[model samples]
Target: MDEFERQSEERGWATAKTLAEALPYIQIYDRETVVIKYGGHAMGETAVAKQFAADVVLLKLMGVNPVVVHGGGPQISAMLDKAGVKSNFVDGLRVTDRDTMAVAEMVLSGAVNKEIAHWISVAGKEADVRGIGLSGKDAGLLTVEKTTRTKRDPDSLIEHEVDLGFVGEPTKVDPKLIAGLIASETDDWVPVIAPIGVADDGQTYNVNADTVAGAVAGSLHAKRMLLLTDVKGVMDRNGDIIRQMTLSEAQALIDDGTASGGMIPKLQTAMAAVRAGVEAVVILDGRRPHAMLVELFTEYGAGTLVKA
Candidate 1:
């Protein structure tokens, strides 16, 4: 590059860095929360996962409350396989029968939760990273009931009942106790939560982690909701990512089934956060190293941005 272009680029970065330095003072004590749904490629990839943890710690240091909620579908599946447990998925929901639920709890609460906590502490950040490993049974954090799925139109050929055995949805969310852990921290505390909800009859139910993240964020009235996944956020029909979109536009995309399959529920949960008064929602790829830092602190971020 020519000297002029090089100097221009340097100057631009210098200005941004200066602004970033000034950001804390401008944003201090601004009662805002951010819920991060960390999963998929991000959780599976080692470098990305640790970097994501570092980013969360940084956010807390910056006075931005980031509640970390994660899923361990891949890890759970692996453990179940190792234990010689047959795996099954009905309509994209895990058939969380008794044995499956036990493994899910162990992996999600025990393995995934603690790993995140350890990484956060080792990443040159001060975080009292607490692995608050829980299922829906404890604290009554979520109330879930059985789901009976059916077609959008009964007369349609594609319509049929999909029985997702023992899988639960986040029908209710209680953030009081969860918030206390963060707020009561004498030092920095990165609360790593596992997605499991409770049933009305005091039974435990396995819920989608994405649903858990959204409910937590909304319950906290977070400023932003960050969803880390495999794709580069919401894309157009032409395979181009839309940098920014409003809630209405995002809802339109979902209603039209442009974001179907597993993505459908994910988008719905994110939309739930925005509707509950978050400033924005970001759906981005977690494959890139330090993707969280780039997304949170710099321009040219990694994925689609959904706004309030």
Candidate 2:
């Protein structure tokens, strides 16, 4: 055979080998629920967004129900800037005032949410997947209360409440709508959710996307919750990635000041999900191409998995 023909044959063989290896992993998660928090580079970059959508479509075709919860921090900030509204963040949580909340709602539910769904719907090479864009307010999906943080005063050592207006945490997540969407037999549908919820007082609140994803997964008793961020999973003090850790190990790391900053909230969300009945929660680098697929279908996996 010619060199070109020989190379083609080798490539075909490799493809077959990969499919053979992935079959068992595919079977293991068949018909299982996977909650993915898509953000960071994966959402911002066009190429990465296409890659992520294709992966989500492939998962649905494989019989895995993938629920995507997305964050639009940059988009919100950009819109706020355009509107000449100053934004503030405390302890990595955006302090959403009335104007900021308005901008956030518009960007998250109206723009980012639909854009992600559209990407998934059009990215499928084989069969086009249908994506349903949803907000936490849709069908009472996420009901939240106003969230508060306690800050200790320097020198005085007095604890005081820091009010983050229009910012809330998931108090109750009604998964009925999501369950119905995933249960559709004729149409394979994926839910793309924006983390905009409502409080008891009929006020709209912008919630942290990671926390929303974890809450939804726990509510659904999902098989896995994958948090896709910019970091290389959980790192040790020496700047090495720890492949896996139990809930206790993760907490210990946080207590020892090994995991700080933004990572603390992610780890805390993971811990909450696992404790609430999710089998495992993974914090992985979203910038890596096909990171979700690699973590799910390969033996090596892609990130730090926290489990009970």
Candidate 3:
């Protein structure tokens, strides 16, 4: 064979090998539900976003149900800045006011949600691509309660409550809508959810996407819950990534102050999901190409996995 012909033949063989290797993993995940928290710096990149869509579509075609919950902190911040609104944060949660909640709902549900669905629809085969954009308010998918945090005084050593207006936590998750989408006759509809929930009094609340994904996974009893963030995974004090951790080990990390800042909330979410019956929770770097596929199908899974 000529040089070009030889290269083409080798490429064909490689593709076959890859498919063969993935067969077992595909079987393992078949008919299983996976909740993905998609956001962070990764969503801003066009190439990565397109690749993520392709991955989710492929998973569905292979009989794995993928539900996506996305965040838009940076986008909301940008919109707020343009609107000349100031934002504050307490313990990593945004201090959302009434006006801020309105803008947040607009950015998350109106813009980010549709954009993610559009990307998935355009990247996959027309016959199989059915991306449905939703928010927690739709069909009451997520019921939320107001969140309160406490801060300690350094001088007096006293603790008091801090109110983060319009910022809520998921109190209940109704999985019917998501389950219906997954159980569609064609199995083509994928749910792309924005983390905006509604209270019983009909107030809109801005929730953390990670929290929403965890609650959804727990409610669905998903096979896997993947929280895609900018970081590689949970790390040690030396900055080395921890591949796998048990629920107790993860709790220890948090109790010892080894895991702090943004990671603290994420680890707590993972712990809650595991306790709620999820098989596994992974905190992976979304910036990596084919991150989901690699984590699910590879032996070395591309992140930190917390399990029972």
* Top candidate when judged by TM-score against the true structure: 2
Better of 2 and 3 by lDDT: 2
Candidate 2 residue-wise lDDT, 1-308, digit = tens? 99999999999999899889999999999999999999974577788888889989999988899999999999888888888888888898899888888889999999899999989988764485788899999999999999989989999999999999999999999999999999987788899999999998899999999999999999999999999999989999899999999999999999999999989999999999999889999999989888888999989899999999
Q: Which should have the higher lDDT, number 1 or number 2?
A: 2
Clashing pairs in 3: none
| Residue 303 lDDT (model 3) | 98
Local error of candidate 1 at 73, Å? 0.6
Q: Where is model 2 more than 4 Å wrong at Cα?
A: none
TM-score (all chains, Cα) for each model: 0.84, 0.97, 0.97
How far out, in Å, is residue 46 in model 2? 1.6
Stretches > 4 Å off in candidate 1: 1-31, 124-136, 151-160, 255-257, 299-301
- With candidate 1 superimposed using the best TM-score fit, by how many Å does residue 240's alpha carbon deviate from the native? 1.1
User: Model 3: which ten-residue window has the lowest total lDDT?
Assistant: 122-131
